[model samples]
Target: MTTSPRRPMMISAGVMAVMAVVSLGGLVFDDRILLGAPIWLKPFKFALSIGIYFLTWGWLSSLLTVRQRLVARVSAVVIGLLGVEYAILITQVIRGRASHFNVSTTFDRLLYLIMGGSIAVIWTGTLVLTVLLFHTPIADTASRLAIRWGALISLIGIGLGGLMLVPTSQQRASAVHQVIGAHSVGVPDGGPVMAVTGWSTTGGDLRIPHFAGMHALQVLPLLAMLLGFLARRFPRLRPDRTRGRLTAIATAAYAGLVALVTWQAERGQPFIHPDGLTLSAFGLLAAATLGAATLVIARGPAGTTVPEPARHTEMAR
Candidate 1:
């Protein structure tokens, strides 16, 4: 059976609306709305948000044939699971209940393994979906390129986020302490006493780097779309080998730049240490690979025979 094209948009809109309401309500009811939520509930909320986003994508995927739909659904499930796992771990950290190895116990280890596997599955599944969609009939080349690039950037973000999970030894000197000491944010007795910061001890700061890397998927793809639109004025530049090559080069360079930033973040000492650099690097590498692949795709001769569309009883209007 086929699904409606509008469903994805509808779901996305609905979820976003709900989230807005929830956020607003939290703000109105509690001064510390962010801190007010129960530890476990926080992850659930985060998972729900991510799940909704992926679900929208899955809903969009349903616009394809049965096989494609199956792939999309499976991918959505994996993404949803990863979202949930992320939420849980983050919540644990927020609650100050997390350990170096939260998955030290057998059960916890199993769960962690499952979550890790789900993440890998989601990444692979999304890439496969991207490839499948690339060949499918679409209204415009720009949209097609947008989708492909979006998927590529998303994979980069996921890669970076994953890398943040890898543990590293802390710097002997604490940057946080130094900053607070130098600034004299508050001093207890003799000299500047190092304030005990909760989040610093945990991996909360790592989120910054992960988010920066992931955001590129949104930023770069939108920029590409804008470029594609501008290129319309210049007929000669449109849909050519050179443009495609340039796109590849630009994307690769963008990824490489992100990697450099990630390296910087990962190299810092103490609280002054750069967080998210490693993850950002991983993200950039993933994007670079995708860029290389896109270059290969765009370089092929024109007028290649199209693949047969998988059987669909009815096509969405």
Candidate 2:
């Protein structure tokens, strides 16, 4: 496939545009008719956003093969998950149960499973895709090695995220929180403390666990950047390093911020601690580990180089 550099940018822009519009619409109709519009409509907006995100991936995958194909496959899994979620939501709407977000009932539990499973699939697929997509095309063996190590660290972050999903009692609570203006689990003290005082069910705090896991996005990507940077700086590594070091630094900083936020949430306690301090602490540790791992990857030795599959390799022999 012909890779068009501009196509990815365009698709990204389009997704951003749609997200902006939806956000604006939500803001404009705050607490008004639009805000209270049929519950089904609300989820659709999110579904549309997810759809756009997946479409962007599809377009990007079409641009190049091999690494791009890996991305496309991962994206397909994410899209499939989103599609199932959309269907379930549509069913809820048709049944006039759109307001139900808790998984107290069998149907709700099934919905939660679908959502959580899909998200997990997307997270794992994304990590694999990133490794294949970001390897340095022009580099010494060391730089290529750094890329592999970086990818490995990122996978660790992904694994940590999946682990967090093991405790998913608050899926419904999270959904209701979205419907209402509730505070997220583990938010730091300072603002008006909001709690899930009345959720569809009473169980665990899904929000905190999910957010903690999602922080891997920054953690893993930053580690990748660090690897890329080390490969460039060391003579034995790659010669033409682009934004590797800078991205690594930025990602490390972002991970720190995520940790701080997680800490704050822990301190805030009762308000953010739907599952209590113990769970929140677990999240904090995970985020901190990700940050620490990023630093380590940044400073680690550049490993072995892997060849970038040829363009024709993406198509046929």
Candidate 3:
């Protein structure tokens, strides 16, 4: 009844912290393998990711100046849905069954549907919080841009998860299995994979972009923080406007990266095995980002613009 926006989310994050530790232990001690990796691996990764996400939202909730009651209600709903998701995932892991994309039995299908539905609702809840941020004023320009753009991009990232739900051509072709979806493209799920990520090595893996995009919530804000810290040493970065411009550039670049990886994955290309076209596209993106960043730094502070020369010499002309 107190309407404290941060408490529930932070508490949820704390629970995830404990779960992460337990899941890590399970990874080491338990010999059970789900799909291709250790059964506990998915739980461990999800625990860490969800913990960080909730913690970020917990902090952001404090920044909201208006609509305390509404914020609290949304926060509660998001947390509750996350709990549902984790419960099903953990249960499946314990039972030595796949939590995601698994419809091997009636029970499995029901659980998967519940998990998917919960995630959709959770994404919608986060979107409402993000829209609220636009109305809530923050004094710092860099931080404001970081939070807004980060949240928007994070929504895009979260939306990408839905892409995995679509059945691949192979899945459609094979009538022998009940599994409906997969993270990997151009190859089956239980093939050779990367280390702890379990991303397919022989084909495209949507998780690469999904992971990169989702973490923009952390990355963009951290960039703003880093710029703030460096401003103490370098006066060029001392201006709020300059810092804001830099943050905006970084945000665009980060979004571009998410797009690039998503494009690469859709083409059935392994991240480590990029062909010429992918490399060329990435090169262009990097060059543009660096060029824009340099221009921003050269502009100096907010109020002061770079001066034009009074007279043009022959060489200058």
lDDT of each: 0.47, 0.44, 0.87
What TM-scores do the predictions have? 0.53, 0.46, 0.93
Over 4 Å off in model 1, which ranges?
Answer: 4-13, 27-66, 79-117, 134-146, 170-209, 232-246, 269-317
Clashes of 3: 0
- The backbone clash count of each candidate, in order, is 4, 5, 0
RMSD of each: 10.3, 9.7, 7.5
| Error in Å for residue 272 of model 1 | 10
Candidate 1, 27-58: lDDT as tens digits: 35544322223333334345444644455454
- TM-score winner, 1 or 2: 1
Model 2 RMSD in angstroms = 9.7
Compared with the true structure, the alpha-carbon lDDT of candidate 3 equals 0.87
Candidate 2 per-residue C-alpha lDDT over 196-231 given as tens digits, one digit per residue, 9 for 90 to 100: 222112222233433443444434433444544565
Winner on lDDT between 2 and 3 is: 3
Ten contiguous residues minimizing lDDT sum, candidate 3: 308-317
Model 1 TM: 0.53
Off by over 4 Å in 2: 1-71, 87-101, 134-244, 266-317
